[model samples]
Target: MNSNVKVIEEKILSNNWYVLKKITFDYRNQSGEWQTQAREAYDRGNGAVILLYNADNQTVVLTEQFRMPTYINGNETGMLIEACAGLLDKDNPEACIRRETEEETGYRIGEVQKVFEAYMSPGSVTEILYFFVAEYSKSMKINEGGGAEHEQENIEVLEIPFKRALEMIETGEIKDGKTIMLLQYAQIKGLL
Candidate 1:
């Protein structure tokens, strides 16, 4: 608890898969006045995302899946192209990403490099995403990774040329924020 703010009350809105809470707080304004405000936060837990690339082939691996939220918003098909990602369910960022990559992309990557972390949608979602990148080779392709069926994730793996992937970003085909960030990072660092 910060000295500048006091949590007055908290109410749990939902506790289905994760949690959602409505909080009321009294914050010390810059003018030295105590202002009461309310906000709802969705805590689905922190997660990790990774972009796999092949330096020799100048290619990158991505996944496509249906995202209900996007469908309800404006996306016509609700299908989105994204990097491999999963919630950190009692596992560290590195381990979680490695498992997700294999489950989503079917590539058992040997090593991954932690690039950065970001709080995506911090306004109403308390999710801090760990970002990573790794070099992938043909030998790493082990299983037919379409995500775990028990979790109801039907993902399509895509191996696209680096230049074409970058073009897709400009064309609005790949609008996923995490995937775009990692792709841009790879381009900037000459990791293609």
Candidate 2:
């Protein structure tokens, strides 16, 4: 909580899926003058993302899904390749990521290394995304994971060579920010 700001009013703008609120506040500027401002913030809750890598195989596991926002914004097919991720509704970051990984990738990984957390779209969405990396082998696969049918998620799992995955970035094939960040992290740390 910054002492430099005070909430004046808050109103719900929309309550369809998550929550959208319009908040008016009094902000103390650098010059020590108080100014009134208003902003709309969407609270979709925090989430967790993970990159599963196979050091022995020099491969990485990723997911492909259709994103409506991308479709409306100019993405030709609206299908995006990204690291496995899910919202932390009531579970902790680790548990949420574990469940998401199994549901999306068919990998029942045992150990995971947390990398970092970040707010992906701070300007409008209130979501802190926790990031992680884990080692995986063929033996870890338990089922043919697509996604939860109840949630209408149609996710596709992808396993690509670490080097080829990097090339996809240059070719504009993998455009998701979290996926790009995780891939770069792996490269920097020499995970593969």
Candidate 3:
């Protein structure tokens, strides 16, 4: 254990879908001197993204939703095109992802294959996102997708041809960082 790296205190700042905490820690810098730093860390709960693929139609399921953060920042429409994703509340990554997939797209994924795990915006946030892809078939039916009502999510699920999804990326329509990374990884691995 690194003795210099110690968390002195932690304070909760927010407790919405994503929780924010202020942390104070001491660490040894390259100069070999102990330094104290304070950071506002976002505990976004373990997040997960799913790439739902329809094997028969060669398509992928995606969602479009209004993101206030993006809207406030500069997106003209304030809408984002992304894979089905959500924050894990006490559940493991796989289970959380599977549940999110069903709630967001009405797709019950079978045999999820883990693709990647990464930190989203590590500069100040402590969100670890797990990415997975599951083979979907036309036989899969949509019961009723729109996210959980308790969370006030108004999601519109869309199915796009695999090739068109790549086009959306090239056209700069898919702007979410994690979604881009996962799609690129899938394409590179010839899984798209």
Candidate 4:
């Protein structure tokens, strides 16, 4: 059996926050026959998601934003309800989550607990999502979460009661896979 696969060619598709690539690889099958396959793959920088909870107010913060991809795919409402998240550029996952949490919700979390690490879309993308949970005091305020100007993100931060957030999940208001998974995980682990 051959265990090595060689890349024949690689091409860049997009060069934004995430880069898409087309790659052709040559490999040998179990039958000892050689073959070449081409595929479009995504090269996403490391990412972080923070489940911000306001302990005093018994509320959780979520963001709603217009996602063009989701709108074009199937969702009638392009707005996605999700935790504060972003891609890591120069910082580690933990630092990235903390920074994003502050940028997206104005909450400066002191200690963040890592929940899990996962692949957002494993089939074709190389994006690894680091999930975290942080407790914030009720005094934490939402100044304005409109993302970085360079990225052109228009973010709306929503501070809803924990129960209401769960209700939104149950009613399909939150359709993002990562958000759903994190919320469900928190519920199962009694973190929410």
Candidate 5:
């Protein structure tokens, strides 16, 4: 609690699986004025995303799944191609991404490089996502991963050429933010 800021109140808007809250606060502006503001924050918890690639094969592993939020918001099919990712329930970011890689893409990843962390939607979401990159080989595939059956995740695995995956970004196929950032990072770092 800085002296310049004070929390006025927090009201819960929803508490089903996660929480959504309306927060009211007052801030002492630099102009020597106090200002009150209200903002809604959705707390779905933090998550980790990893881009699995094969330098030898010049390819990357990706997954496609239906997203309800995207669908409701005018993504006609609601299907998005993205890197392997999942919520960080109790595990650390690296452990979470490794587990998600195997669960969603069927590749047991090792030697992952943590690239960066980002607030995906800073204005209204409290999710700080950890981004990573890892190398994968065919031998790492232990099972045909479609995510946890109990969670009803119908994910499709894709092994796309690195160059083609980049092209998808221009053609509007790979629209997921985390995936795009990781892909662009790969391009910038010459990982592929």
Candidate 6:
């Protein structure tokens, strides 16, 4: 919509799992001269993440799983400890988080507070992530949550002290962006 830029053309680079497109565009420079630029963007849809905490227990629920991308990018083990998250296939953000929490962490939570939303990576990825926080207790654990079986998800649930979760960040053990953000949010806001 800006007069400073115009998309020249877009080509589908790949559509195997999600859509990746090569975008060529005409951009007006600082001097008002048009220049051609191209960039590749990956569209994997949007997702939601949540950090579940229990004030009484001073604990937070987290999940661990193998991440192929992390493995290839200098992560020795490729295993990442992250907050429960999932792509919002067709549900609203709240519904998506609720569903993902139960599926990934085995907690049927009620009343989640939307903390914020952010783009985890914006340079070449088209995904805006929604974040949430909720109070949880042992009474809510309904099953051994390890993600959905049909989706081939093999998530490991972990419940640890809130203070320990923060230390994991310093130890470089919890490197996931969304998870870290949520944990920091809890700490700054004294949610625990």
Model 3 pairs whose backbones collide: none
Candidate 6: worst 10 consecutive residues by lDDT? 97-106
lDDT of 2: 0.96
In model 6, how many backbone clashes occur?
Answer: 0
lDDT scores for all predictions? 0.96, 0.96, 0.86, 0.83, 0.95, 0.96
Write the candidate numbers in order of decreasing TM-score: 2, 1, 6, 5, 3, 4
lDDT of 5: 0.95
Candidate 4 worst ten-residue window by lDDT: 138-147
What are the runs in model 4 whose C-alpha is more than 4 Å off?
A: 29-33, 55-57
Worst 10 residues of 2 by lDDT: 142-151
lDDT digits (tens) for residues 1-192 of candidate 5: 599888999999999989999999999999989999999999999999999999999999999999999999989999999999999998999999988888899999779999999999999999999999999999999999999888899999999999999999999999999999999999999999
Per-residue accuracy of model 4 over 1-192 as CA lDDT, tens digit each: 436688899999888867899999998888878899998989877799988876567778888889989999998879899999998987999999987887777777788999889988887998899999888774555556567667788888888888788788889898888888777776787765
TM-score of every model versus the real structure: 0.98, 0.99, 0.92, 0.87, 0.98, 0.98
Clashes of 3: 0
Task: For model 3, state the Cα shift of residue 32 in Å.
Answer: 1.0
**Global lDDT of model 6:** 0.96
Whichever of 3 and 6 has more TM-score, that candidate is: 6
TM-score of 6: 0.98
What TM-score does prediction 2 earn?
Answer: 0.99
Candidate 4 lDDT at 27 equals 82
Q: Which ten-residue region of model 5 has the weakest summed lDDT?
A: 101-110
Q: Tell me the deviation in Å of residue 3 in model 2.
A: 1.1
60-168 per-residue lDDT for model 2 (tens digits): 9999999999999999999999999999989999999999999999999999999999999999999999999999999999988888888899999999999999999
